[model samples]
Target: MTKERIEKILKAGANVVLTTKGIDDMALKYFVEAGAIAVRRVRKEDMRHIAKATGATMVSTFADMEGEETYDSSFLGH
Candidate 1:
């Protein structure tokens, strides 16, 4: 897997990221290093509820998270 894509996935500001398919060992290590929690095998329906409850927008790709380096605050639910 490309580190660039992995970096993008890792950089999402959410406190926790839920994925239908589990992440790999490398990703797990990166997540630990970044202090982010990644929950795998999340039910699609549950993911919907989580986004709604946490006021987070569900994004399919990390490319949309722009202008993060200029700001320190995490818009993602904490």
Candidate 2:
């Protein structure tokens, strides 16, 4: 998603779950600053290293999430 859209979601009180291939320091900082949670997918062999480096939880899933609006705002700040 675009930064603007992500910001709008954050403003709307939705908790974010960023799923990306790699985790960069800048991306980590941006997500934290925006009050969102992020998870990075990495090779099983490198999962431990990546998780240690970026502080992002790793998960295994192959589902397609395009155009799916699954974020809910009710669970935030409680």
- Residue 24, candidate 2: Cα error in Å is 2.8
Candidate 1, pairs of clashing residues: none
Clashing pairs in 2: none
TM-score of each: 0.67, 0.36
Compose the digit string of candidate 2's lDDT tens values, residues 6-73: 56456656454544476666666667887687566645656556555655444334222775443334
lDDT of 2 at 10: 68
Task: Please give the distance, in angstroms, between residue 57's alpha carbon in candidate 1 and its true position after superposition.
Answer: 1.2
lDDT of 1 by residue, 1-78 (tens): 345655665555544767787788887777778787878889989988887888766656444356343212243554
The 0-to-1 C-alpha lDDT of every candidate, in the order given, reads 0.64, 0.54
Q: Where in model 2 is the C-alpha error above 4 Å? A: 42-78
RMSD score of candidate 1 (Å) = 4.4
By TM-score, who's the top model here?
1
